[model samples]
Target: MIQVTPSIAIDESELEESFVRASGPGGQHVNKVSSAVQLKFDIRRSPSLPNDVAVRLMKLAGSRLTQDGVIVIVAQAQRSQKRNREEARERLLELIRAAAVRPQTRRPTKPTKASKERRLVSKDKRASIKAGRSKPGAD
Candidate 1:
């Protein structure tokens, strides 16, 4: 089981991982060994996530989420399969944890009266300066 938050825990079975050969930096070993880990988790189908969290997760996943609502995380920074696998799992947990937090509601506010007055005052000052710069008889 993977614990994302205090209230949210996902079962190990919920995560699916596949291994593929990584393309860079390992020289001859890179072609021979499958060091990259592809981790997939279905946001829509997961029984472990709350509806609100799942919705937020989908939004947060963005391009990472497939058409079928599966989030695909590919980890290839590490040369070893185990390191890459762990990195993928950690990333998934971080994403789920981020989705668990509810966003603060934005409170709309009008500009202060003093601020509006200041803005109008500044505009008038600028207009006067420009007016003073023009030829006196050219009005």
Candidate 2:
């Protein structure tokens, strides 16, 4: 089980992991070993997460999320498969932990009287500057 927060714990069975050959800087070893880890979690079907957290997780996933609501995180920076796997799991846990927090709602506010007056004053100042640029009463 992965403990995301005090209230949220995800079962290990909920995650799916696959390994693929890593690309980039490693010489011959990179071609032979499957070091990249692709971690998948089904946010839509998970019983562990609350509805609100699940919704936020889907939104936070952005491009990595599939149409089926599965979030796919790819970790390949490490050369060892174990490290890559751990990295992927850590990322997923962090994402879930972030989603667990309730977002603060924004309170709408009207412009302050001082701010409105300042805006009008600036506009009037600009108008006066432009007025000065006009030709002086037909010379």
Which candidate comes out best when scored by TM-score?
Answer: 1
lDDT of 2 by residue, 19-95 (tens): 99999767899999999999999998899999999999999899999999999999999889999999999999999
Backbone clash numbers for all candidates listed: 0, 0
Which 10 consecutive residues of model 1 have the lowest summed lDDT? 1-10
Off by over 4 Å in 2: none
Per-residue CA lDDT of candidate 1, range 25-100, in tens?
8999999999999999998889999999999999999999999999999999999999999999999999999999
Can you tell me which runs of candidate 1 are displaced by over 4 Å? none
What is the TM-score of each predicted model, taking all chains together? 0.93, 0.89
Q: After superposition, how far is residue 112 of candidate 1 from its true place, in Å?
A: 1.9
